[model samples]
Target: MDRIPILRMGNFLLVTIQVDLYDRLAQNLESDLVQMVSKTGARGVLIDISALSIVDSFMGRIIGNIGSVSKIMDAETVVVGMQPAVAITLIELGLELKGVHTALNVERGMQLLKEKILIEESEPDEE
Candidate 1:
């Protein structure tokens, strides 16, 4: 299994993992990813899935799990670049993601993350 690599871009962290199938890769890093989110102190995350060909129940679960962990770490997780076929396959497989953020590409994903950060930063303090 190839290791997931993490890169920093501004306030967001980009996690790139090469995988033929999203499920397998997610299974491999479920725990490690959770730890990574905690350790990095990242405000947001962009998961580049341009390499994945398909998504299954396993992948959906892992995505959901990562989102849960990211929430606890106060980081927003955005999955990016899922192919149309893969998206249809995931739907047909009855694989449902539990409210995790998603984007069509890395740039959009990063934009969304940055916007979230900006919104948070701009919020007025509640006295």
Candidate 2:
């Protein structure tokens, strides 16, 4: 079985998509990632999709679902390195990827994750 690699770096989980994702693979990634967050109690998730030149609606929703689910688990998700075509396709699909933050690359995504964690930490919890 082929699987996407999810690397843990301190309080973050970094996923670099290096291959095309089939339906089963994408499903596995979603399940595995959430499980990883539960196991590691990660503060953030950074997903790199630079290798992918094409993204269909399924992939877009999977990405969006990852962000939403991770947020519910108290982990922030940042999707980085989206190609222009992928971005355009996502928009055309009418998918509003809520709760997902994006960056140009992994470096900026990590920085944004740090900032998100710090900001959320410093803010008072609502009643």
lDDT of 2 by residue, 27-95 (tens): 999999999999999999999999998888798889999999999999999999999888888788887
lDDT (Cα, tens digit) per residue for candidate 1, span 38-126: 77778887888788776667777887888888888898989998889988988888876765799999889988988888888888764
Position 115, candidate 2: lDDT = 98
What TM-score should be assigned to candidate 2? Answer: 0.93
Q: Least accurate stretch of 10 residues (summed lDDT) in model 2?
A: 118-127
Give candidate 1's error at residue 125 in angstroms.
3.9
Candidate 2: which pairs clash?
A: none
TM-score for candidate 1, please give it: 0.85
